[model samples]
Target: MNLKQEMSHSPQTVILHQHPLTVHTCHTVVVGSGAASLNAADTLHRMGQTDIALVTDGMNRGTSRNTGSDKQTYYKQSTSFTDADSPLKMARTLFNGGAMHGDIALVEAALSLKSFYNLVGIGVPFPHDTYGQYVGYQTDHDENSRASSVGPLTSRYMTEKLEAQVRRNGTSLFDRHLVIGIITTPGENGDPAATGLLTINMEAIDDTGYGLTLFNCRNIIYGTGGPASIYHRSVFPKSQAGATGIALEAGAKAHNLTEWQYGIASTKFRWNLSGTYQQVIPRYVSTNANGGDETEFLEDFFQEPTPLLDAIFLKGYQWPFDSRKLLENGSSLVDLLIYIETQVKGRRVFMDFRRNPRCADEQGTLNFDLLGETARQYLTNSQALLPTPIERLKKMNPLAIDLYRTHGIDLEQEYLEIDVCAQHQNGGLAGNHWWESNVKHFFPVGEASGTLGIYRPGGSALNATQVGSYRAAEYICHRYTQPPTTTDTFLAQAEHLVQHRLKLLKNLVVNPEQPSNVLAFQQELQRLMSRSGAFIRSRPALAETLHRFQDELARFPNQIHICHLKELPAVFRVYDMLIAQIACLSAMVAYDERQGDSRGSYLIDHEEGTHRISHQGMHFAFSLDRDFRDQVCETFVKLDPPADSPDTKQTTDAAVAAAKVTHQWVKVRPIPEYTTWFENVWADFRDQKIFDEKRG
Candidate 1:
C-alpha cells in the first residue's frame, strides 16, 4: 500500500521516496490510477504521444479496481448482430435519457464495439456463446439485452488488464502523489486553460508531506471516479476518492449533478440486491431496536403484500430507483418501501434468504404455486421452485451468496441488511463530444465525465469510461493540441498558484485546532447529504442543507487541522465531498426552480404546483451527423402533494447561499458546428466503420 516507498515496480512506475523533487512535467498527465487512467495513458501512447505519465493516490485502490457485485455490467452494442440493434438506434435510446447530450450518446455507441473489443484485446475475459458472439442480458432502462459481464469483479479485471497494458507500454506511473490543485492560465481565447496540476507526495517518510510537485502538461486527463462518498450510505469501496469536486474547484462547469443513481444494496457487504437475487422472492423484514417484533414492512405500504412482493421480485431487473415507477405504482415502489422503513420508521430492514415470506393466504408458508405470474414463470423456467431463497439462489447464481460469504456476510443464515444507498452519479463535469470539459485542455474520463443521462442502462458506465478515455486521448492529440513548454511565463504563473495552495495547506498545520475529529465531520456531511439530497429532495430541506453546508464551510478554517501526513488525503477527501455536495445542491436548486418535476433519481416532494415552472427544451445536435436533432422534447418534473410534510429547518443563510451557488452553464451545452466540428474535432477520432466508412 505504501506505493511511494516501494519504488521497486518494474517496467512502469518511477517513484521518488527520499528525494525532494519539486516539479515534473509531461505531455499529458492522467490523474487517478483507475481503469480510466490506465486506458487513457495507453490511448495517448497509441496516438504517438509517448510522453504521457499517470499520477495516483495509490495503486490497487479505486472504484474500478475494488468494487464489484454478483455480475458487473458492461454495456455495448451486441456483436451478435440482432435485427434491431444498430449504432444509431443505440445512440437514440441513450440520448433519450433526459438531460444527456445526443452527440455524446452517439460517440458512446459508435465507439462501443471497438471499445469493447479493445478490452478483450487487453485480456479481459468476457463470456461468449458457442458461436463466439458475446453473451449479454437485459438491464435497467434498456429494452434490449445489450449488457454483458464476466461476473462481479469485471471492473477490477479491467483495471488489471489495462494496468498490464500500461506497464507493457512503459507509461510513467507516479503512485501516491495526490493532486490537490490545478494550474489554469489564460488561453488564446481567454477561457481557462489548465496547464498543470499541483500535487503532494502523501507518503513523505515522517514529514508533513511538504514534498510537492507541479505537473505541467499539454493536456490533463481526469480519470478519477465519481464522488460516491458524498452520501454517508454509499455502495462504493471506501478507498474511492473521486475527483469531481476537484473539477468543480478548478472552475469546470458541472452538469446534471442532481441526477444520480440510487438503489438497494446490502449494508454489510455493499453488493447490489438485483438480478436473480431479487427474483428469488426473499422475505423483506424490519426489526425493532430491541430486535424482537419482526415485521414485513412492505405490507403496510401496499394495499396487499402480494403486489409489493411481486414488485420486489422484479426489483432484480428494475434496479435503478425511478420516480416514474412510483407514480405508476410500479416495481420501483420496492425502493420506496425500503427507503421508508429505514429513513422514516427508524428501523433496520433486511432481506432474509433463509426462507420465503410467511404467506398471508396459507397462514404460515409461502405457496410458490400462488406466486405472481412473472415470478412463477421465471422460477419455473429456471427449475428453481425451491422452498427457500438460498435454494433458488443456488440454482440461479450461487455466486450471489458466495460473494457475501467472502465479505464476511452469510446471506443464507444471517439477514442481509439493506438500505437505499448512493450508487453512481449520472451527471459529471459537463463534457463535450470528445469528453472535454468546458475548461480547455482538460478532459474527463470515466465517472468524472458527465456523458450519461437521467436513466442509463445498467452496466453502461464501464463502456462510457472506455469510450471516453479513447476519445479524450484522440481529441488531445488532434483538436486541443498544446506545445510542450514550461516557459518562464507559464512556469511563473503555475509556481505562484502552487505556492498559494501549499501555503493554505501549511496554514492548517501551523495553526492547529484540537486535532479535529475528521471522521465525525465526514460522517455528519454524508448523513445530511443522504437524508436531504440522495433519493428524495425537498426544497426546504435542500435550502436547509445548503445553509448547513455553508456553516460547515465557514467552520473549515477554524475546525480543520491535519496532524499527520497520512491524514491529508482523508481531510482533502472530506473537503472535496463538501464541494461535490454543494455542486449537487446547486443543480437541484435549478431543478426545483426551473424544471420543478421529479425526474430520474432526483425526487423532490413538492406540494402540488408549489414550484411549477417551465423552460425552453435544451436541444443539441450532439449525436453524430445530428441524427437525434429532432428528438428534443419538452420535459417536466412534478410531484403530487405528499401525505404529510416534514418540518422545514429555518436558516437565513439557506436561501441566500442556495441562490448564490455558482453555475457557469446550468441550461446550456456546446452547439457543435457540424460542418467544421467534424472536420475540426471528430475527423481523426470518428470510427469510420460505425458509419460504414462514409467518414461521418
Candidate 2:
C-alpha cells in the first residue's frame, strides 16, 4: 500500500435516507483536538503513517487548553544534575501508585524524556538553567523533584505547539465534528474491533439528515478526555463533553471507575486552588445564599489559628482531597469543612484573600512566627510572609492573580467563591501498555485511558498523554500498518446501525410537541452523579442511585425530545452521558458490595460508620475498609437487544435495561522484573520482540 496515495484519497459520499453522507476512509481516525489527540496525529505522521484525520467537537476547547493551577505541573524524569533518577527508579515511583499496571508505568518512565524533549523541540519552552538542565520542583505524591512547568498555562502551550505541528504535517482536520458512535466489526479473534466512526458535523446540523458523516478507518485513537460531563461540580471546561461512553457501549472495559480527584476550586471562574493560591493562607468564609452576613467559618472548628493556617498552606501542594488527610486534623479537613458549609448547610463559601484567617485567640491578627515549621519554612523561602493573602500572592505568583483577571475576576479585592469540585478522573477506559483497549484497534490515550491509578504525581497526566500517544502510534506503525477495510465492506456492517440512528434522529425532529428537554436532562444527570458518585459515596444511597439511573437509562430517547435539528448534537451528548453514568454507577455499586473502604480520594459512607468527623452541629460517620489498593476494579458492559414494547415501536426503555454492566476485582499487575543484561536484551530488540511482551 502506498501510504502517500492513501493519505490523498478524498471521502466518498453515500446516500442513506435520501441524505448524501460523506464517508472518509483512512488508516486511522484520531478522535479529539486536545494535546493527546493532536500529538497522536503528528506522531503517527512522523512515524510515516500519513493516512489519519483529526476529528474534534471544537478546536479551542478541552481541559488541556482551558484548565490549570497557579503553576501547572508537568511530571517527568528528573533533569537536574544533582538528582539521581533513572527509568527504573521513576517507574517504581509511578508503579507504587496503587492499582497501576507495571508495564505501562515502565513504558511511561522509559519514554518520559523522549516525550518531554519532543515538546521542547516543538517550542513548548520548559524552563532550563544556564547549564541547559531543566530544573524541577516537587509535586503531590512525588518523592523526588521531578515536576516542571511553564507557568499556569503549561498545557495550553503544549496544545498550541502540538496543534501547529499537526497542521504543518498536513494531517486532515475535522473541526466541529462530534463523534456520536464507534463503528466496530469482528476482527482477528472474531471479537469486535474498531472499524470506523459515526459523526455529526455541527456546521451542517441544520441540513437534511443532521449532517451525518462517517470515517472508515482501520484504527482509532480515542482521546476525548475524562467523563467530566457526568458531574455538575466539575473543573473540566464546559466544551469537554467526553465521548468515552460511546466507546464503552461498543464493548470497551473500564478500569478503576470509582477513583477521582476532587479539590477546592473557585466556582465562579472554574480553576484549581492549588500551589500559591493555598500557600498564601486565605480566610475561609461563608455567607448566606444572597452573599451577605459573612462569617469566618473555619474559626468555629479550630481552637487556635496555627493548625488551621498550616492546613490551608498545605492545600497548596497537598491539592487533591485524600481520605487519609481527613484524619488527625490533616489538610483534607479543609475540603470536608468546606463541603459541609456549602453542600450540607446551604451556604456559599469563599476564600477572602484580603483578610487573614481568624481564630478565637488570634483576634484577626496573623503571626508568621506561630505558623508550623512547614508553613514557616516555605513562606520564608519564597519571601512571602506578607500581611494579607493577596499581597503574598502578588509577591509569590503574579500570574495567579493575572489569570483570574483574564476571566473577569478581580481576586485582589473580591472574594473567590469556592467549593470541593471534581478536578480529574484517575480512572477511565481500560487499556494496555501500548494504550490499546480490550477491543483490538481501539486505543484510548490521555485521560480517556485509565492508566493512572489511585494516586498520581500532580502533572504526570500531561506526561502520560504524550507517552501513550507515542506508544500507540509506534505500535501501529510497527505491527498494524494495513489498508483499511473496503468502503463496501464497511457500509455492509454499518448500514443497519446508521439506519437505526437515522430513525431516532428523524423522530426527534418530527415530534415538535415533545419539545427538546436536553438541557434539563443534562442538569438532572449532573445532579445525580455529583450527589452520589463524586469523592464521597454512601453505600446504601448508591444502590438506590444506581436504580434511579438505570430507570432513566431505560427511558432515554423516549424521555429525550428535541424540537429542532440543531439539538441533535446535544441529544447524542446526553445519550452518551447516560450510558457512561450507568456503567460508572454500576462500578460504584460493585465496589460497595465488595466492602471497598474509604481510601485514595473518596470516602465510603456506611451504617457501620467506623470513622467520624464533626462539622458545625452535624456529625458525619463513614466505614473504613481494609487496604485494597493492590487490587484493580475492572468493568465491562454487555449490550442486550431492546425488549419488545407493544405501545411504541422505539422501546429504548428495554434498550437501557439491556445494558448489563458487570465488574470484577483482580490483583494489580506488578512491574516487570526483567533482566537488563545488555547483549541478551539487544537480541530481543533486534528481533522486535520487546513490544510483543504481555507482562501486564
- lDDT (C-alpha, whole model) for all candidates: 0.72, 0.85
Per-model TM-score on C-alpha atoms:
0.85, 0.96
For residues 208-264, what per-residue lDDT tens digits would candidate 2 score against the true structure? 667899999889999999987999988888878898788888889899888889998
Superposed Cα deviation of residue 682, candidate 2 (Å): 3.1
Q: In model 2, state the lDDT of residue 240.
A: 81
Candidate 1: stretches off by over 4 Å: 1-21, 205-209, 360-366, 480-482, 509-515, 609-660, 664-696
Clashes of 1: 8
Name every residue pair that clashes in candidate 1.
Answer: 102-623, 103-622, 103-623, 275-316, 596-637, 597-637, 597-638, 598-638
TM-score between model 2 and native? 0.96
lDDT score for candidate 1 against the true structure: 0.72
- By summed lDDT, the worst window of 10 consecutive residues in model 1 runs over 618-627
What's the CA error at residue 689 for candidate 2, in Å? 2.0
Instruction: List, residue by residue over 537-633, the lDDT tens digit for candidate 1.
Output: 7788888897788667544534566656567677667767777787787667655665456767646665553323211231111111111222222
